[model samples]
Target: MSKATKTIHAAMAAHVSSALDALQAAGTLPEGIERGNVTVEPTRDPAHGDLATNAAMVLAKPAKTNPRALAESLAEELRKVDAIDSVEIAGPGFINLRLSDNAWRDELRAIAALGETYGRSTVGEGTRVNVEYVSANPTGPMHMGHCRGAVVGDALAGLLEFAGHDVTREYYVNDAGSQVDTLARSAHLRYREAHGQDIGDIPEGYYPGEYLKPVGEAARERFGDTYLEATESEWLPVFRGFAVERMIELIKADLALLGIEHDLFASEAELQAAGKPEAAEAWLREHDLVYDGELEAPKGKTLDDWEPVELPLFRATRFGDDQDRPIRKSDGSWTYFGADLAYHFQKAENADALIDIWGADHSGTVKRIKAAVAALTEGSGRNVPFDVKLVQMVQLLRDGEPVKMSKRSGQFVTLADVVREVGKDVVRFTMLTRKPDAQMEFDFAKVVEASKDNPVFYVQYAHARIASTLRKATAAGVAPSADGLDRLGEEELALVKVAAQFPRIVESAAAAREPHRIAFYLQDLAAAFHAFWNLGNDRPEMRILVEDDAEITSARLFLAERIGQVVRNGLAILGVEAVDEL
Candidate 1:
């Protein structure tokens, strides 16, 4: 555990136990109130004070006392604790506690001691977690829509690892799908063009992008027109395999452009190797989750091509889904959901927890997937749980005008294009500035702006500022070491206290599977550091490296160096760049 986390936990345990004792003494509580429910979190509104608790409101009904009365009594008890500078009962029986300045100052010293490891935690306790994301079909280049899931999943994995979870980043390859067949046909058209044949307007259903020309040329070089005159059935598999392999290579390159590397690349084709869909079918049958049924046409919209058909279906409604879903088509081919269910089952066998990051358009699929897992793990009694995080769309804009993108026209913005335009650091940091479930707008102009509005720049600037302070200290023949961190002033001390909260932030972000929390925390930390820096301009003593006092300069430099280390560490977790000299 990081030093910041240890201090926060100790502070919480001490304060909570004291409050329970006071409640017991006043006889205003039940025989045993679950103190485990009490929590200390930094309040969103800083005016409410440092940390606030809703413990009084939560315990009031159980104690049969007015919430305000309970809060008042709790406040009186908290005031006696040396760690608490003051305690106040706010609206609706909330207890807000302000810690003494020394508490904040001491946190700075702890941050200096811990350095880059300041915000890390052991909350996950080495639980194996698999995060599967960006499983885009290998038909063509990845469009802008695929960017959010890739960034969120990667960031979430980083957050989990920092919080001490054994996390595996995975990418599921959809090479067995019909999309790859379409890609083969598309490549065939390109091959015809390479052979000087008039391929015409890119046959109706095939891809029309010029990106496939290389694949075609490579196919021609390897096959030497041998398969050119062959039937579709004889040559389709050959072309499909070649095209999918090349597409995967292209996808890997795109991912590398954005600094993402998956620990596992699971293939859908592997699930049904050698003409056997047994893995998925057997798992579904073992749980009695599969049955023959007819699916109703989708509601709210009527499809002219809709036809009622009976087939093998997963009894998803038995759990919590709205209706049963098909696992096999009438033609005996496995449905998309069937392959996914089996893939998740295979994933469950390898990891303690499963997390799939998907696009928002797949929201309707969440319930059935969870239902399948619950059914599969019914009697064996192992906790084989799964979580699906849906990342909402990112609308790209340039100067407030929406950037046009159309996949059909092959005119959509590619992930590689965005990364090249804004650079990986800006792309990643901006992508995570908003919560996963919230729709985000990526403004190209604002992302590159060198102002506070650009969180990436602001955070980087804070790190750079701290580095400058250290450089100034070193030039004056003073070495800032952990031993001298005790001499930090109020402003320096406040920055340190904020830095000490990193481990707690990591723990919270990992537990919630919300990496945006880390981004938000970093921005706030930067704001605090910037505020302190501005204060230094007004008060010479507040400057991190004071010229007159060697001891004071060394202490301030120690705190500043720690701040820079923490900024780098936090940025690293978000897969963002921390510029030492912005």
Candidate 2:
């Protein structure tokens, strides 16, 4: 196979698989043995070997032999391959293989050959995946509360695409909720104020953001006092639609500052208007998945104050949820879960998989929604995949002090404000430093600090240093060349090995739906390159661009160029720019 077609780990896995096939053909092992459980990956400790495999352990039982006996046979077949420098059978049955120097050198050439397209994989096999995120209620502008989810979802989509999945970036617009009603009422106050009427301070239960002033002004400009004195029923629907439209526009603009654009914007109001929820309800009822049932009262409410009510309930508990969930209120209105269930069912119709990025506060609703999707899809015998990833809130701070909310947004710090203060790359890279579900603190002072403690700066500086070295080398007429790659030493080869892990990282991160793994891997790769650079401080011979010899300089420059390429690729997955200079 061509170098561009497979990852280093994948190549090693194929070698093991070939050895197993040879064993079966020789009658040393049973035919048709399941190889799905076999795995070949980098060893946890580099001292063990370049790669380790569980092939022997996985096949020993089927072969009716001891693990050590099977490993001995496997090692014999593996030794026939030219690339295997040594194959060691560790405890029980683990087979560890160390490759020749030519293997690592060839990988460096592959890296330089692939360039920006490196680290991409076809592991997803073109499965259509729907990623819905940042479905914040369209009641206000984008705030810090919604920032993390937006970044995570966008990065995950990028990662999936890199892994060769047909991904759809979607945003579920929550325009049918009661919050829009509050938004319309708030817009009316601002509208009345725009008409020279003294609307008093924002009343309770109304949005108080000064950001809504533009919406009010737009409403005045369009309506021109046509509904100034109309009844609430006459103007409520008009303002609701108008406010939702304006807020969605504001949200898209705010998201643009962070380079996030969704491919589709699904509307809750439209779904209800098209009777999707009713359709889902009818399907559930026909399949005995839902029925008229009464639910227990509030967990902490007194029994005397609790009123028993009968409502249509879904069998969420049967699918691992805590309790049966109500799909509609007793008054015959669809509940939030009802609308959300129908929305996910609609999403599943066009995609093979679904992923939702929700805030940590929505953790309680996760099980119910997962159950709904399971029932909806499994009942139809489709078995579509679904995942709900919860992202925790970010605590904004400056110089170790908790930052105050933005007066413009009224309730929280706006995402645009933070992006403007530090930059889109800093916000994005910092949000990915820690896992999404873990608590994160975005310190205005710390993220921009030019030190090793700051991962964003450290990783970017590594790429910048490599870029600077390449530029200076070219200035002296030492262009990177693959001809001198054979002259490189173990340290240079070690850097290539680290960079070669990018493909595996991308595939694993996409499979796990955790894009932060790419962030973590970049930091490690950056550290390795930085350590190699520091080697030159005491040993002049270890420097990349040596004055006496052009051959070694070309070899090291080639290594540095590829290292920079890997850094840029990893940063690209996180939607961060790889700066050429600090």
Q: Pick the candidate with the highest TM-score.
A: 2
RMSD of 2: 1.5
lDDT of each: 0.82, 0.92
Best by lDDT: 2
Task: Mark the regions of model 1 whose C-alpha exceeds 4 Å error after superposition.
Answer: 1-5, 9-11, 14-35, 43-49, 52-98, 195-198, 274-279, 297-307, 481-489
Q: For candidate 1, write residues 309-419 as lDDT tens digits.
A: 899888888998989988887898888888777777778777889999999999989999898877765534667668999999999999999998666666778889888
Worst 10 residues of 1 by lDDT: 1-10
Cα displacement (angstroms), candidate 1, residue 137, comes to: 0.5
> How high is the lDDT of residue 514 in model 2?
96
In candidate 1, position 113 carries an lDDT of 62
lDDT of 2: 0.92
